[model samples]
Target: MNPSASKIQNPETTVPKTPQMNERDFINDQLTTEKYMTNSYNIALNEASNQALYQDLATIFKETQDCQRNLYNLMFKNGWYAVEQAEQTKVQQTYQQFTGYKSQLPYSVQ
Candidate 1:
């Protein structure tokens, strides 16, 4: 009996399935940064239906020398709880960041 062959036949040991991605979805989620997100947002805005675009450069704009360096620790987390929390906070801060981002930002978004 081959242990490797037996292990390969077991489906229960596999990792959970990630969400499916179609052609457009793949391109849509390509970038994970607010800057690229904003640039993509810009291009998408021209093609999108809404009149104004809501995005910020906070993710890509690291004017601060050590910005987000503290949060990099999430990479060592166990089950992505840290990553999820980081994302939630990032979104909230990004929302708040973008709230005032307009005035401080380089260009107009709305």
Candidate 2:
């Protein structure tokens, strides 16, 4: 086997050769790629629709969160009210003990 032929067959020893290509084909492919890619992909979406959808979703989420907060507030408020009521009841009992309801002398004294 010839050493020169063996060297040509080896990729490491061989020089890289440029292939012949058509300029028109290259330009066409570049133009096609540019046409497919756009600056804003979501430009097709309507502004009105986007706004309405976002508002609707935001309203639903806000309502759900507000409902949870209101429930917590109501629960705490009721607990506080119960405590206040119990304190008032204790005060009332003490007052009743001091100024006990009188039978007076009874109907016979009247």
Best by lDDT: 2
Each model's backbone clash number? 0, 0
Candidate 1: tens digits of C-alpha lDDT, residues 32-55: 243354555456545645433323
RMSD of 1: 16.9
Instruction: Show model 2 residue runs off by greater than 4 Å.
Output: 1-51, 80-110
lDDT tens digits by residue: candidate 2, 1-110: 32333121212222224474444344345444433432122232223367777576556555545554554344344331122233555679988775554444466745
What TM-score does structure 2 among the candidates reach? 0.24
Q: Residue 105 in model 1: shift from native, Å? A: 5.5
The whole-model C-alpha lDDT of candidate 1 against the native structure comes to: 0.39
The estimated TM-scores of all candidates read 0.19, 0.24
Q: Which stretches of candidate 1 lie over 4 Å from their true place?
A: 1-83, 87-90, 105-109
